[model samples]
Target: MPAGTFTMGDSSGDKNRADGETPRHEVAISAFEIDATTVTNDAFARFVEETGYVTEAESFGFSAVFHLALAAPEADVMGPASGTPWWAGVKGADWRHPGGRDSDLDGRGDHPVVHVSWNDAVAYCEWAGRRLPTEAEWEYAARGGIDGAKYPWGDQEVDEGGWRANIFQGEFPRHNTCEDGFLTTAPVRSFAPNGYGLWQMVGNVWEWCEDWFHPSTYRRGTTAEKRTLVTDPAGPESGQSRVMRGGSYLCHLSYCNRYRNSARSQNTPDSSMGNGGFRTVALRVESQA
Candidate 1:
């Protein structure tokens, strides 16, 4: 948790579909530390090599494959295979083989690793002598001191000055010219950092946080709700899905603009997909309380 103060949530724009990003407010956070970027295959390889740890994706023997990245023996490839036809359950798609046994992370050592679950992320954090950030901490870091700003850089559009982060730049799931220089996952250092020196915090991958999912808590009987103004406020005690942040490259205005800083989404602990992955954060071994 790097020390900083800024408004969280959407402060200036109505340019979003996510209702949870409304009522941007000021928030003060303590000084802690976080990952400079999302974890990569190389990084995770180090953990696994040293600890012999196996990820859930590895143990389960399957990872979700995007419809476009799947091989159809004669079928309609539309969206992600997890919930859509485009996604196909591929076997042996762990860190070693991101696309099952056929694909590999050859030149993708620097790319943000995908196919991880909430459980996998937690295990990595523990092995690295760190802990995942609470939802509040994750949001604070993602804000990058922009406060109520719509993005880590600002309210400026992605094309006004060209895309600053890695996100879908073309039409929906149909065509992606890699206009932003990357089609799937850009090089981890492909973009600039936010106000707090955090890179790729807004896009690249949706990171898992140490919190549960809860939508009703954000609603305040029309006045003001305390839970909405979360301050290191860990979400619900139990939930079917865990908290995830920092939208992924799959996000697009035509589909999901979850790439925004204020934007958030979630998935079950057991679920894994091309767009669903996580990054780990640390609070300093001494800050553990």
Candidate 2:
């Protein structure tokens, strides 16, 4: 059980971060139980086998594949790339086939599963008797026990003695030596948990939130419009993309540097691509007899 009050977001989190994380604000939340790490492949597989569940990607016949994931010879090809020409649609890019056709969970049973859509996550949560965290709840948990200091651990960047979350350890896009001992999503518990006992709050793969992304909904976060400020934002009433938090392994300091605890982004809940994934949160209820 992790319970604490934390400063939601602040400009001090990342000194050179995008405007989306600005105007750090104070947010308080009640204590709750959160999975220490993102749901794992094996865990998800069990859920499917038990309930005969099939994910959206599986039903749709394909999911989006990262450019680099297709570098292997045996890797299935993705084509008709649009927004990010590099992103290709792979027929087998579901949780079971993380890297499209060729790649497998392998020894990565503990690594957080990726390529999940919001609906998929919701289904899994329902099956587990859990639910997706509200946007406010997620922000509070990500901050861990830290209050408004910036970042899960504080304003400081990865220091010499301390290691941060599992984001891009090397240069962006090309040339990853896996300095963090992982080229992709590390084991769910690979790194230390934040003060709130939540893993991958700052990095790993982005987790889907129940909220739909609306620039007017969030007071902070990068947006050119004043209408973007949203309170207790549950995302847009109707929109193509839902909100996503906790940057992915694809995030890099040089390019998509939004791995910060408070930084937020979105994707079409119906669109299954990229390394988007999710985690489950629990609600504690007292029963009256």
Candidate 3:
């Protein structure tokens, strides 16, 4: 995106206020190069093959998997996560075995690799000579230059003119109608690209951002006289959880209606789940010669 200023945060007026998407503010973003799609299993596989690196999930011998998508047998299943019964901690669940030990990336190499933690994504970035986009940059790119638009395509609903994203169509965590031709994750390029030519920016998987999450990050440093134009806001200086943007396939209107441009979520740097993944942004290296 070229250097430009745009209003950031919930313009819809219907977002979950607790998610820190409030206090709508203007932000000026610098031009940066971002990947058109989330990193695929194939891409990650190359990173692993070359570096011989093991992901956090692989090290832990388990990762969170949606109950409906669990392919592990009763022996490999470790029960549901606390509070979110829809997710089960399955042993042997990693990026390679997304569902479980029984699952493989046979024909799904092009799909976004899940069960990747923020630390894992940063490891991949280090190997790939790239970095995760900041929360501000991610939102700016997802907005596609459309100031304060709800969805990436515009303010139109996901199911309005057709399936604009790969989110739950039926009752979430129970039955997915697959109205969008996807029960789990669709290909990275399943939906139409946003105006910035970025694909699946708001669905398929939650992309990690390089920012510590805080509920009141937007409300800081504001006065009656002047509205600060936060240029390239990098989020809080310290927090336990990093920001995650672009809701995943598990997102539904009834529950996680966070598949919009301004929606936000967070998780610990080491947390990994079936619905989590990330894309990288190229680092601008200044010429030394």
**Comparison by TM-score, 2 against 3, better one:** 3
**Model 1: per-residue Cα lDDT at residue 115:** 85
Model 2 scores worst on lDDT over the 10 consecutive residues at 222-231
- lDDT for model 2 comes to 0.71
**Total clashing residue pairs per candidate?**
7, 18, 0
lDDT of 3: 0.91
Cα misplacement distance, residue 61 of candidate 3 (Å): 0.7
| Ranked candidates, highest TM-score first | 3, 1, 2
Candidate 1, poorest ten consecutive residues by summed lDDT: 71-80
Residue-wise C-alpha lDDT for candidate 3, range 1-289, written one tens digit per residue: 7778988889787688789897788888887889999999999999999999999999999999999899988999998888999999999999999999999999998999999999999999999999999999999999998897898899898988888999988877799999999989999988799999999999899999999999888888751136877788888899999999999999987889889999999999999999999999988634445
TM-score per prediction, in order, is: 0.87, 0.85, 0.96
- Best candidate, TM-score: 3
| lDDT of every predicted structure (CA atoms) | 0.71, 0.71, 0.91
> Model 3: residues >4 Å from true position, as ranges?
222-225, 285-289
> TM-score of predicted model 1?
0.87
After aligning candidate 2 to the native by TM-score, how far in Å is the CA of 55 from where it should be? 1.1
Output the number of the lDDT-best candidate.
3
